[model samples]
Target: MSDVVYTTTHRVVVPFYVYAGLAFLVATGMLFTGAAEFSGHYFQPHILAITHTMALGWGTMIILGASHQLLPVLMEGELYSVKLAYLSYTFTGIGIALLVWAFYIFHMGWPAKCGALLINAGVIAFFVNVVMSIVKSKKENIQAIFMLTAAGWLAFTTLAGGLLICNFTENILPDGSLHYLSLHAHIGIVGWFLLLVMGVGSRLIPMFLISKYDSPKILWSIYGLINGGLITFIFIFLREAVSVLYMIPVLCVTGGIVLFGFFCRKAYRQRIRRQVDEEMKISLLAVVMMVLPLVFLIAVIVTLMTISADVHMVLAYGFTIFFGWLTAIILGMTFKTLPFIIWNRVYHARAGTGATPVPKELFSSRLFNIMAVCFIIGFISFVAGIVISNGIAMKVGALLLLLCAFLYNANVFKLLFHKDRML
Candidate 1:
């Protein structure tokens, strides 16, 4: 019932946006250069570089920063240490830069190993900080548990990735290194990213809607379904089990998504604030996007059993999960969360004095709409290009996506530098 917003220091959050912006620029350039072509396989050097850029540089970076700010709010307590937060960011930024460079050049040398080590340490620091905060907090919530579990998965992901890197040098996994890549990717995507989103989104969506709705039971069910699915997946995946057994985790994750969709519907129905703003509307669109990867996964599984798994379908599935679902949610939530943080920093003290610009007034909605349209077009075109093997369509889609990234950065800058005016 309180409108209080808890956040970490600006130093912790702002640097993350800077890294995300740089990552977006790099990804757009990769797309423009055709390094991102579908090419019927997921494990080329350039593609790996691009994926790391988006995953580590943009997605994980933002999540790391935002979680520092959001966890205190979720836990109803202060961060364990501000200094640790800064250290985590520094190590992660350096690690990402080095790793990306190594991948770009197709070299897995000492530099890559060092980068992997640094990243692992950084993640460990972050995990420790979050755990400490959770332990110290008096208020307990399911959202906090979601975050802790996600952090644990992230640690597992990094450890697996480090082994993957080692495989290049030592040839540790003689069976075939590529086979383990799916485990690494899924742990990061579904275990870390999807679970974290569900945890955070469950709380934020209702709050933003001004809905007093609270369903602890529904949230617990979703948590159980996702983690249960993931645990089962790890067991099946490790044994190199039968193909059909894979469907079990897929079904569990699908159930979690369906339950989450129902939860969103209930929140919307209960919302006191009608006429949802453009920002929240975009966020809601991400909820729809969540279903897309499920559809793609079903196609992938069907093809796997019947026709030996089409490469294009597999690529489509990854594309939908990363770009369509994860990116959309991050894009939407960035606007919703960042503006309030900036507005509080700039105008909170001046609030009862004559007049002040509301948080919504900090940026241009027209620009947001343009970015949204471009993103949808680009996503659809890019997926179609992959489906049909059309290079030209892919190029066009990449260009549009590049434009969307530029517009997004521009708007972020606008909010960061908004000047106050007296009314």
Candidate 2:
């Protein structure tokens, strides 16, 4: 059998990585500079700008690029159109740029709407390409099915986001603009980003470790629970149909988590190689990190029951979910995924032919361990600062996070720069 050849359909993916790296810089800068607390501005534009930059420009951009590369492998078919991938990237990049500018300049009119429209188009284009490709493929894999389902959620995410932009610019809704904004953000997070990443992880993590554990049952369970929760959430929260309907989403989300935990346990048990790599270890920790938010989430619900939710509590909630859960998973995955991508593109062709060394010899695991510790320290401290309302702690935590970011980046760079030397 021939070795799998990984080739990105669009070159835009590499630029997205560089852009994402810069986004980390800006986000860290805001943290150290205390820009989260603007002078006399509760709604800090600087914070908003940085937050959106990381979410849209960095996280989503990389996901789109990776999806384009993986769709063919998962579906057992060539991508329907590489040109469409390029088109989507261009539109998405333009949209992200405009949105960032609009945030900085507070231009909530045509610029915001246009940006939203562009992003929507990009998402639609991506969905069309992937869905059509899957339909034509010979193999019907569970991972591909999960991906298609995730694409449907992506459509809902973009639709909600587009309406949110309209709400930001004008009054076109019944309840209020903030209501829709909340709806849109959660849908994107829970439905699009979290759901899709988990779907992919269920496949890649086991395969990378050469495990034969099949997770189709768990995948289907998670799929039903998440979408069911989201549907119930929209009907109850957005339409204001029933106050008690909030419980449906909360319960379904919990069910999804339970199913995922089972899948992880099964994979760990079934790994052919008993001794896992550093990336797997870090990813395991990330799986544990998912529970942190559920704790805070339950607290938030209780607090809302007793009294009106405080703004600081809301801030803490956001910080915990975005930084604690999402950042941890991304940081862990980056170390593993980036190395593989680099190995495939730069080193794979030369390996086993006396032309290159193994990819594992390129990096220092000790360095990665140190970086992981610092990151965890920083992340915990940052969340604590928000809860305690300590600006100094937040600043220090941000600095630590910045250090972790640089270290991780350096580790990856070392592999790229020293590939030939190791050989």
Q: TM-score winner among the candidates?
A: 1
lDDT of 1 by residue, 213-311 (tens): 888998899999999999999999899787789899999988898889899899999999997987788788898998888777778778877767778
What are the lDDT figures for the candidates, one per model?
0.85, 0.73
Decoy 2 TM-score against native: 0.90
User: With candidate 1 superimposed using the best TM-score fit, by how many Å does residue 250's alpha carbon deviate from the native?
Assistant: 0.5
lDDT of 2 by residue, 258-296 (tens): 788788888889889998887777777777777776676
**Distance from true position, residue 103, model 2, in Å?**
2.0
Candidate 1 lDDT trough over 10 residues, lowest sum: 31-40
Off by over 4 Å in 1: 1-5
TM-score of each: 0.96, 0.90
